[model samples]
Structures are given as structure tokens and as C-alpha cells.
Target: MVMKAPVADARNGSVVDRLVGIDLARGLAVFGMYAAHLGPDPGEGGLVGFLMELTHGRPSALFAVLAGFSILLITGRKAPKSGIAGRQAIARVAIRALVLLALGSILGCLGTQVEVILEYYGICFLLVLPLHRLSAYQLGLIAAATALVLPQVRSSLLSVAPNLLDPVFNLMVNGYYPAVTWVPFLIAGMAIARLNLNTLAAHWRLGLAGVALAVLGHGGSLLALSSRALTETSLWWSDVDGAFEPSKSSFIVKSSWIAAPHSETTLSIVGSTGCAMIILAACMLAVDALPRLRKLVWPIIAVGSMSLTAYVLH
Candidate 1:
């Protein structure tokens, strides 16, 4: 599934594996963020604008999922590390979380239009620490449960939490990328990483799963809307076009069926995740089907390899 990255001997004896598909996916996420943050408004760019609109919320979900996969890669590839190795892995992750939190907080103070997700990611990393060692089936089940359950839980908590917790908790609950719904993406990533993704069968299976999920999410939203006697007129249009409308920035979720970007609604999460899976599977399959394609897309692969740097600098 992934090529082992070469590493010079470190005193601690840690080595990292690199997957081209994952890198390619991360690179795309970085560019998607660019499109979302820097490209022309969806209504302005025409087709390109539409593509930009599509990147609105899905890229963040992709990034979060990859983060989970990378977390699994770091702790242990196919199995959990034990004893001294395990302790060291825990320490590395904890330190990384703290650093991200501090960096995110500093960025948050800059009053930028873009929502800072690093703090949320840091929190997610901490939360995932205990579950990193879980088997694929276990993580998959948890991911499914979270995808279905956490959105309602988050909604309930928000309804009651005008004075319950601190500012960070608010960010984790209702901010741009709330951990409550977003964590499922990570869990899904970890679960996928636990399996042997190198096989053709795996790729096909993942792709089918992706298609099913995408349909489930988008189709479910449509079905729910129709069943409730709600039509297109009741909902807002243009996720990208809406960026300019400050009043629309804070959306009012009329029901659970609304699958708007950044809503953290169940359908929203599922749709974003399905898109992520489809993209990732496609990338891996592409490289495998045409090895030369890998060399041609070296720039993207390189960008993906250093995603964090690419992210912050851009």
C-alpha cells in the first residue's frame, strides 16, 4: 500500500513511512484550501468558480482524515507499538498537539477571515491518543457511530452551552471545523490505514464504499428534505457565493437534514468524507495504473510531502 520512506538513523530509532497517494491527497487539500481561501468567488470564476465552491468544506475534512491516517502511521503502521516505543509515540503526539494549539491560538488572534483549524486539530490529536491502537473494525465502528451520533450531541450541547465551558471548548463544539463531527473523519482515516490498502481489491472496495457514502449523504439529505415538505426555496444556495454574505455566515439549521458546509450536520460530514475517500482512492489507483504518472505529478507529490509547510506559507 505505501512505500517505506528512507530515513537516516535517529537515536530514538523511529522511521516514517510515506504513501504517494496520501501525499497526493494532502497536496490537493492544500490547493483546495488555496482555492477556498484565495481563488475567485464561485459566482465569478464560472466553472473554475464552481470547482472552488466544491472545495469549500470538503478539503478540511480530507485534511482531518489524512491527519488521522498519519497519526496511525506514526504510532505504528499495522500494529500498535508497545512498552518503550509506545511511550515515545505518546510523547511525540502530545508535544505535537501542544505546539499546534499554541500556533493555532496565535494565528486566531490575527483577526483573519479564514477560520483557524490547528487548535481543533490539536484537540483531536489529544482525543485520538487513546484510540490510536484500535483495530480497523473497532475504529470503523466508532467512526460510524460518531458520524451518526455526534452531530446531534453537538447540537444539543450547543443549545445548552451559552455558559457551560471555556472558549476552546466552544471552538471544538461550534467553530468552523468542530471536533465533534470532524473527529469521525479522522477515525475513518485511521481505520482505513489499518487495512492493507495496497491491493487492487482494497482500492475498488474503498471506492465503492465512497460512492455508497456519497449517495447516502447527498441522497439522504434530498430524501429528508422532500419528506419534510421542505424544498430548495427554504434553503440557502451557493456555499462559495455565500462567503461574501456576512449575514449568512452564521447559518440557521432549520433541521438535521440540512447538509450545508461547515454545518457539522451528519449528512454534511458523510458527504465530505465520501468525497475524500473517492479522491484518495482515485489518486492511489492512478499512480498504480500508470507508474509514469507518478513522476509527472512529482510537484504535487512534493507539495503533499511537506503539507504543513505548504499550508502555513500559503
Candidate 2:
């Protein structure tokens, strides 16, 4: 699982080695998505259900974050500033986006229950193109702003958008994995790539930061949920007839501050982003601490290496 120290190429001095740990993380994400899609629903409450809940929104966020990392690798680990090379890199990304959009459209036509992410992913790629030159700190700021602000913007937009065009509105805001809310994951990944992830200390810091974010997000949500201001009315209560009704409401009230898993709320975004960071940090640590295990998991790494193909085929 450990990455070989980045070997400098004599001709370019650029580090030319793959981080097997990243691939391993991607492999896990792919498997999580599989469990989410193909595995039978472990209906609401039990160890199995709890595990499913943990995996619910986080895997896709992990994939999105990895997409940003891959984008950086493809475009050159360092910023290109502005030149023929930069222009060419951008062109390649645009073409890839188009291909993803086409593939997603084709897949979407099959009417499978699985919500397609490729098209939205393509849009996210385009969205970050102009900001590619930003430093990691700038990107982090943007990510934070996007996570904090975009959900509220989406909520406002949702209320005003025409019901006749609800489908389109949903894709942009209300649907499973809306682009506006998901883009932050990509930005955060790009920021992480700029950091010194090879060191154990860096990984430890990232893990601790992730834990803090998760606690803040989830704790804030819990506090909001329990407040008398929110509980004074029946609005917070379950209104459905079924025993297995989802505990979290799909509807987003203006005053609602509680995070609901997969609800696309601001707290949900922050919490999921934290979960993603923790997973990546854990993967990095595992590889660094147990390099020998990499060979045993080579197949998983191979699957991750060709993740796009694997995702499409699955």
C-alpha cells in the first residue's frame, strides 16, 4: 500500500510514480458504490443499515474528490500558469468532459435505478477550469465558500424554478448529487493535492482536521434538531404512514439547519466532505504503514487504475 518515494526523472526532474494508496482508496469507493447500487437494501436500522447509511453519500463524494486529484495529475501536478501547454491541457479536459457527458446520457437512457454521476461530473470539470490556476489556499477558500453558500442558493433557486422544468432544476439542485453542492469536493481534493501528503505528519493533520469538521457538522445539526425553536411545531415530526419511512425529510425548510444524510443540505455537504477527507487520510496512512500489503491488494489497485471503465461497466 505504501507509495514508492517519488522518483525524479533525469530528463524532467518531475516526480514520475503512481501513489498506490490513492488507487486503493478509489477501489474502496468503487466497491462502496457497488454495495450502494447492487446490494440489497439493508432496510432502516441495524448494523447493516447503519453501515449502509455511512456509505450512502460519502462514496460518491470520495469519487468526486478523486476526480479533482486525477484532473491535477492529468493537467500537470504544478500549475501551468498560462501558455500553449495550459491551453492544450484545458482542451483535453473539455474533451474528456464531453465524452463523460455522452456516456452518462447513454447510460441514463437505460432507466436503471442508479443515478448517473458522469454528466454532472463533466459539468463540474468545466466549472473548475477557470480556477485551475489558483493556489491551493485559494482553492480551499473557494471550496469552503461553495460548501457553505451553494446549498442556500440552491434552496432559493428550487423554490422559484418553474415546476414544469422541475427535472432540469432537480439536476442542478434537488436531484441526487447536484453539481452545485458536489463541486466543493472537487475543489477540496485539488487543495489536498497541493499539500505534502507523502509525510505521515501531513496525513495525521489532515485526519484530525477531518475529524473536527465531522464533529462540527454533525454536532451542529444535532443541536439544531433538538432546539425548542424547531421542535415547537409538528413540522419536525414524521408525517408518513409507513414504518420504514426515512427518518430524514426530503423537503428543505428555510429554517431547517439539521444535517440529513443524502439530503444535499449544507451540513450534509460539510459532513460528507469530512468523511471523504478521513477516508483519504486513512488510505494514505494504511499504505505508508503497511507497504507489503500493496501486493496483496494489487487487483484492487488495478480496478482503481481503470476506475472510469469499471464505473461504466458496473
Candidate 3:
């Protein structure tokens, strides 16, 4: 049975009527980031290393997807608020974006090994203002198009200019969370919100979609790489020239895709998006299946509820 949550507004203007499952997922992201930051290096080589590696890109990708979900939650779930309410929501998001940007900037100046993502988060939020109005299908198409094309666009521009070192350029296209390609995660999350997530059927479809995309993306990348190795043809969608190694292979070879974390290839985008969707769907399903589990994971939910603070404190 679907649990219907009572909608409540927060006095502080934060969205309070949250999906517990999402909070749980966010909590996991927060904790996963901790693991990513504090855990042993992936190069350690063992089950522990593998587990540590898993924490690397997926948590942050999950965080970005949830960021999109949070955007919808802040504005209006499944639908954008209209007129005055809409304007207020927009303003609120804008303000939050600025706060995150400022906070991220400050944190970045501290010179930690961890790349601050909040500033980029803020940039994406500001970009989402007009975008929040698009239909789920439209947003999905935009996301797909961006994932498939934006990275290539950026790569070509970079190769041509080589010195496009402007702050805005870096923030939008080349940064840790490049808004150019990375915005797809946010858009995908928004599309998820547009769906009828209250239904078991919906949950199943979301999960299935995740599986399908993961297989398509990762499997395709492997196939492409293998093909490149065999054929000695460097068919690439990412910056092939940058990754090309003549000594490694007497014949230059680069594939059209890469599944490596943060590679921003079509495959990485698709696979990471799939992984995020799977996590989100699984969290939602688990919450629905075992309502009692909420009590068990209360600490995680609590951290997720205060994710920003937790992130900053870290």
C-alpha cells in the first residue's frame, strides 16, 4: 500500500513534506561521501578497495540526482506552482543557490582534498528556474540531449581554445560538476518527480529503467572499448585526443564511450543516471515495503534532512 504523507509547509520556508525514502537516500549520500572522503583508498586492492571505489562517483552522482528531486520538492512536486506562489518559490531557490555558492566558495578556499560541489550545485539551481516549468518528457529529452552532446561540445571548444580558463566557463562546462553535462542528473531527478511515484507499478518501472540504462551504458562502453582495441580505430565521443596513448597501443585507440566515474562520457552519464535512479527507486520501495524500517534508519533520515549542514560541517 502507498503511504500518503500529509503536506506541511515549514516556517523556515524549506520544504517539509518530504518523501522519507528520499531523505533516506540523501542520508546515504551524506554517509557515502564520508566513506568516500575518510575510507581507505580504492588502490588498496581487495573487497575493501572495491567497496571504497563504489563510494567514489556514485554517491556524488546520487547526490546530484537528489539535488534535482529537492528542486522539485522546493518548488512543487509533480507540478510547478503558478503565479505568485511560483515567483516566491523561484526566489527562494535563487537565494538558496546563492547561499550554497558562497558556502562552497568559502569551503573551497580552505584547500581541502575534496572538491567542493556546493558552488556548482548553486549554479545548477539558478539554471533550473525557467527549466522547472518544462514537462517531464521535455526535461527528459533535454537531459538526454545534453548528456549525449554537451560534453562533446565542451571538449571540442576546449581543444580549439585550450585556454578557456574563465571562471564561468570552468563552472558551467569543465568543473567537478559541470553544469553543461551534469545538469542532466538534476533534470533526470526532476523527471522522476513528475512521474506517479506513489504507485508500485511506477516504482517497478523506475527500477527497471535504471537496470536497462545501466546495462546499455556500461555494456555499450565495454563493447566500444573492445572494438577500438581490436580494430585500432579511435572512435570517440569524449576528448579522444586527451586520452589517446600512442605508446600503450602502437596504433592509437580511443572508444566512443567510457563508464569510468566522472568521465562525463555518454555511457558514464547514462550509467550514473541509471545508478542514481536505482538507488532512488530502491530507497522508495524499501520505505514502502517496510514502513517500520523508517524507525530503524531514523539517524540516516535525520542526516539527510540536514544534508547541507552535514556537508558543510564535513
What TM-score does each of the candidates earn?
A: 0.90, 0.86, 0.89
List candidate 3 segments past 4 Å from native: 1-15, 230-255
Q: TM-score winner among the candidates?
A: 1
- What local lDDT score does residue 140 receive in model 3, on the 0 to 100 scale? 87
* Residues 69-154, model 3: lDDT tens digits: 88887788777999999889888889999999999899999999998889899998888667888888898898898888877886
Off by over 4 Å in 1: 1-16, 162-165, 229-252
lDDT for model 1, please.
0.79
Q: Write the per-residue lDDT of candidate 2 for residues 1-314, one digit (tens) a residue.
A: 23754546667788878777788889888888887788655456578765665566678888888888777766765554357877887898889888998898899999998999898888888887677777788989999999899988887877787353555566667666788888888898888776667688988888898888777776667667666454423222221122222344333345546455555667767777777888888888888888878778878778887788999999
Tens digits of lDDT, candidate 1, 197-236: 9787788888889988888887777777677664342222
- Give the Cα error of residue 272 in candidate 1, in Å: 1.0
How many clashes (backbone N, Cα, C below 3 Å) per candidate? 1, 1, 0
* Model 2, CA-based lDDT: 0.74
